[model samples]
Target: MRKVLLPTIIFIATILLVIRLFYLQVIDDTLKLKSDNNAIKINYDYPERGYIYDRNGNLLVANQPSYDIMVIPKDVKEIDTSEFCTLLKITKEDFLKKIAKAKVYSPRLPSVFLSQLNKKEYAAFQEIERKFAGFYIQKRSLRDYQVPCGANVFGFITQVNDKIISKNKYYNSGDLIGRQGVEESYEEILRGIKGVKYIQKDKYNREIGSYKEGRFDTIAVQGKDINLTLDAELQKYGEELMINKRGGIVAIEPKTGEILALVTAPSYDPAILVGRQRSKNYTMLYHDSIAKPLYDRGLLAQYPPGSPFKILTGLVALQVKAIDENTSIICNHGFSFAPGRFMRCHCHGGVIQLHRGIYESCNTFFSTSYMRTLDKFSDPSVGVDVWSKHLKTFGLGEFMGYDLPTGRKGNIPTSKTYNKVYKGWRWSSKTIVSNAIGQGEVLMTPMQLANMMATVANRGFYFTPHIVRKIKGQIIDKKFTTKHKTTINRRYFETMISGLFDVYNFGTAHGLNVDGIDICGKTGTAENFTKVDGKRVQLKDHSIFVAFAPKDNPKIAIAILVENGGFGATIAGPIASLMIEKYIKHKITRKDLETRILAKDLQPEYNRFISKPIRDTLINTKVTIKEKAVVTIKDTSGIKKRTALKP
Candidate 1:
């Protein structure tokens, strides 16, 4: 019986071993994958990125053929290193360093050695690529900008870093990723899936045939094309108007909340970030500390809203029934909230109503209204919180959740904010009276200001402003389409709208109104200040303006801010009017205004903050521009310095 049991156990063990072998060979493919890895070389086929078109179907960005030099460290064979380096226009040290980096990334995987070669360079490299055993040329596509504008909107692609590779499994060494703007926001949809082919290799590293007859191969899928809400003509025109200027301009469609033109001054050509010279050009643009061309002022720069803020003050007051359209406040050149403190006004001495208050930009009237609204509640903290809530309804103080990757949630101070500032001391509306005039801690981005204007146009609601109108074969996120209602009642906006309309009829912005267009606008001049060697010093004021055209059924809402441009009427107003006219009328009737703005150079005003030596060095440095209207600056010493001023 013991002998029979031993023989039976041995037979069972033999049967189990046979079953395991069958499973590994027929059912499970893990061992097959390992075997294939040893004898197969995988190559990726990158598909062309989808084209980008403006709302009017004008091509904004298209793909151009490019080549990347790829390396496989384990497959490298000794060759003429000098000839290879010369052919690729790289030094021997650089080649060695790239090979070392590729090895560190993965000795078996392909890594980009050099990327984005032009046609001429590609042709030259193709001739000598066969001489290098481990190196190969991979075809890819880079952005070919149809126009030179919208660098801030279009963004650029760059090689993924190690951190990115570690975070995202889809990316490998030398893969491209979007850096900012729309590209970064919609990277997944824009960068299509990469196809792969596995080629079998012999022990001598010679190509034998396709691995497993290409059963595991995949075909690349092209990226989905997108249509942006921008108007290419308007974007080009706005960029031209912003020549020699350093600021931001944002225009939104009131009804749709689609961003029309987002212009940032000192912007570079998008093409500069596409080719082999991208790193050098990007470094220059990045380190130009004075201009900060890489900074998206439209979505990032926060500043005091100035007079445009008065509109919100009036709206909040009206919503709380603290003030009405008929409510009048007298201006004796200013209002005295405290014994020795006074808030000054620019309006003529007289009794002013809400309508007149907006157009005249009456400091005394708005301050009094702000005080009355806050004083209505017994506790100033509760009142300030309520006021803050009202502002938040307008999408102020918080990130607007726009479809961009970069933005700032402009400050909207609450009761808690003031509590910290006052440090437990008793305070009232009088203590924060400067806030009544859009000064103090109230800050907003140009995009926020434009959205505020759009809210006013919608009479208490707004759609989240977005760049892409539609994605091919897909619906946009519902967040962009959802209506965001402000705290103010819809009826209250009419009074403010009437006041804004009068701004064009007889207020500060009257002089810059477009012919036959009922433009409702508010002008603002935020006092600029900065710390110069640890002392707060006053700088030239920043000009600001916000407006919506056609008044009733508004088509466009826009906000413009010009740093150190003096009064809002002087620079910001005219620029907004021109932009509005260009967009609505599709032609410029104010040739004189256009000519003056085109010729005006404010570099000297900017230079006061930056050292003269630095300014001199930057002068006469040529920056590439497209769509004509390029200026050959002899000296740009006076433009406002971004580093010299603080919000």
Candidate 2:
């Protein structure tokens, strides 16, 4: 019995070993992967990035071949450093630093030693390709801008950093990443999946096909193309008009909430930030505090909405039943919420209704309406909150959730905001009356201002503003398609629209009317102030304008802000008119306005603003800071000085 048991155990053990060997060799394939790891070399095949096109199918950005010098530190062999440095047009110190960085990143993994090599540089390096043991050339696709404009819209590509590598497992050391604009907003969709291959080395040192006979290899899937809502012609025209001016212009389609034209003045050619020159050009743009070409003023720069904010004030008043179309507030050149606290108005003294108030931009009428809105409520805090909530439906007071990466949540004050400011004091609507005419604590981006007009044009609802119009073979996010209705009723917009229409016909922007287009607009002169040597001083007013054309079923809604450009009717108004005419008619009948804008150079104003020397503030003496820090700063008599404790 013992001998029979021993024979049976041996036979069972032999059968189990055979079954396991068969599973590992054929059915499992796990050991095959591990077996190839030591003898196989892996390589990646990167695909071409998706092309960028405008709504009209005009190509905006395409791809160009780029080369990166990659190194695997572990595979490096001692060679003549002098010859290698000369071949790559790099100094010895640069080479050493790059190699050290690569080693620190990973000794076995590949890292970018020198990247974005030009054609000339690539040709020079090809001669010494054989001498370099660890290094190899990697081909990549870099952005080649079809047009010179829209740097802010197209954005740019750059290499991944250590921070990014640690967060995203898919990205290695040498991979490129998108930075801003459409490039950044849709990076995952635009950057297609990269394919990889593995080649095995036989014991005889001969190269063989990949594991599983190339079945494991994948074909690169090209990135999906996208269409932007931007009208190339309109974008180009707006940018040309903004030459020498420091400002932001945002235009949107009222019906769809599609961004038509986004212009940031003092911009650079997108081509400059491509290829090998990207780093140097970016550094220059970053340091230029005056123009700030890299800054997206349309989305980032926040300023007081000025008179255009009266539109929201009027809408909220009507929604809360504080004021009606027939609501009249008499103006005696200005308004007085409290004695000695006079709110000045340019309107002549008379019975001012909502229509006359908007066109004339009468401070008294709107301030009264604003006060009535809060005064109707039991608590000023609750009333102010209600008023603020009404405005937010117009896409103000928060990030509008646009497709772009960078933006500011333009300030919209509520009960909480004032609660912090006044603490427990019993504050009245009069204390915050300055908010009625778009001044006070209210701030908005040019994009937000444009979106407000879009909401008005849509008759109290707005689709979230977006740059992407279509993604190939896929629908856009439902949020962009979803209509957001304002707290105000639809009936209120017509009355507001009528007042805005009259702004072109009989008011401040009368001179800015296009011949055929029934343009509706509001001109604004926001009081610009900043701190100089710790003293707040007023600079020349920032010119602001908001408009939507056709008066009914409006096609375009636009807002613009020109820093230190005085009256809105002068600079911002004309630019708005030109943009509207150019977009609707496809030609500029008002060539005179275009010529004046083209010839006008605000560089002198910019120079003077930038030329102000900023120095340390000393006690009992006058000190000067830069213009943005103080603008037209002359008075420092009451300014505070920072005094450090004596050592």
Candidate 3:
């Protein structure tokens, strides 16, 4: 019995020892594994990007599945160098360099070599994929721009760079990010949540099975879809009209302030920047300096509004109570500001009413009217400040706050600006006389000018101009959709509108008038300078026209700028009229006028055109007599990229 008890005690001691050993080996194993995993394994998921569409439900930008062949440098082993290179269609030296780059980037992270492979290439790689242990395909999506209407406005997407990642944690290496335009503005909405999936692997590093049957996996949510305000047809036509021309056109609904069509010349297919050939095409576009097709001239260009600016001057005079509809001023073909200085005007006028003055674009009347408005102010500086404020209400000297990301805050000088330049507030009435006639330091974007015309057409209010009408299923926010009021009085717009109608019917833009449509318009010829070898040279004048059709309940308010166009009445005026006529009547009527206008080739380009010094004492200077050319109608088949240079 004693011997049995001794044996039992030894067995109990043995059991106790085994239990302690189990605690150390089994329980601590998890802690050690955790530390090991912390050193090696890191996981990431891809996020889905947003979709884009036009107002009509036509897909503009979408996504297409793409694949990248990635490699884990350290994990790669037993790779048949020659065979692998042959399959990948790469040389041995190239493969080695790529592997070296992968090591430099990160060994644990997958490095990409062949991206956006075709279906055939992908299939061939998939068949032999198992042989390559550390190599795999990373599924991704690339932008597929179906239509390239708004290339600059829509922008593009590219892999996030280090700078972007440093700025925002939402992005990391290999993340897709918005590069410009709407994509940047609405990044929050367009960038969707990321999805994740995990699978257990064996000692050979082969994926065994799902960890928990996808229970812990998160599904990707699609990004919010965007709907634009662009009328696809009109945008297409507008682009066609501006073909070959170096200028831009902006048209908006006067009442809603919704941009109908915005066209910039030297445009290209936006789709060219997407898919397999993306990098190649992008490099080409980036280096093309002659066309600069990527530049968004519509929103970025800050040009003198020319005659289109007269609309604002008319509104300001009436709003300031400095002029009435019947207010009359005389013009002797020019405005005499001082003894030797004179502001030139186009032919025709002797004591004309305020309405007729605007119709004829009489510089003399505007100079006097502008002086009267300034004189009405209590102080000269105060008057300039007040005048600038009024202009701001019309969306000048500021951004239109359009949905588009690109825009310029055009210059509208205040008294402070003038004082900074010329020093002190001691300047007299003639100091800013040019502002009265839409000249001097004032500059406006085509978008701003278009909206201003819309404000005049709507009588008092305009909506914040936007290219997008909705995003996904949600309508564009109320802040931009709401109507915005200008500083001009409600009743003051009619006089301006009536005068514009007369301008189209009998004034400078008379060639633009249609038989049935009461087209309202005003023309401007702005003198600009060209410098050659540090010498100022006289260049051709810019032809500009602002117009709206039907005159009442206007549908389109448009601003047309033809780079270096000789005369507003001849070049810009006819082009604008053709667009209006095409939109309203669906055809061109005045073929003779259209043919003649198209035939008159504008000699110089915008960058080359210059303004000459006006003869201080010269009179009846034979004015380089321009003949009124006629347009000839033809089938609109090849009308795309028609070049009509407006000076």
Each model's TM-score, in the order given? Answer: 0.93, 0.89, 0.83
Model 3 CA deviation exceeding 4 Å by range: 1-50, 81-86, 89-97, 212-215, 585-647
Rank by TM-score, descending? Answer: 1, 2, 3
Candidate 2: list runs displaced more than 4 Å.
1-38, 202-206, 609-647
Q: Tens digits of per-residue lDDT for model 2 on 551-588?
A: 88799999999988888998999999999999999999
User: Best candidate, lDDT-wise?
Assistant: 1
Candidate 3, residue 464: the lDDT equals: 90
Candidate 1 RMSD to the real structure: 5.1
lDDT of 3 at 538: 69
lDDT per residue as tens, model 3, 247-321? 678888777777777887656667666666777666655653434566677888778777677677777877888
Give the alpha carbon lDDT tens digit for every residue of 32-123 in model 1. 97777877888888887778999998989999999998889887888898888888788989988998989999998899989888899889
Worst 10 contiguous positions by lDDT, candidate 2: 623-632
Flag the better candidate by lDDT, 2 or 3. Answer: 2
RMSD of each: 5.1, 7.5, 11.9
Residue-level error in angstroms, candidate 3, position 373 = 0.9
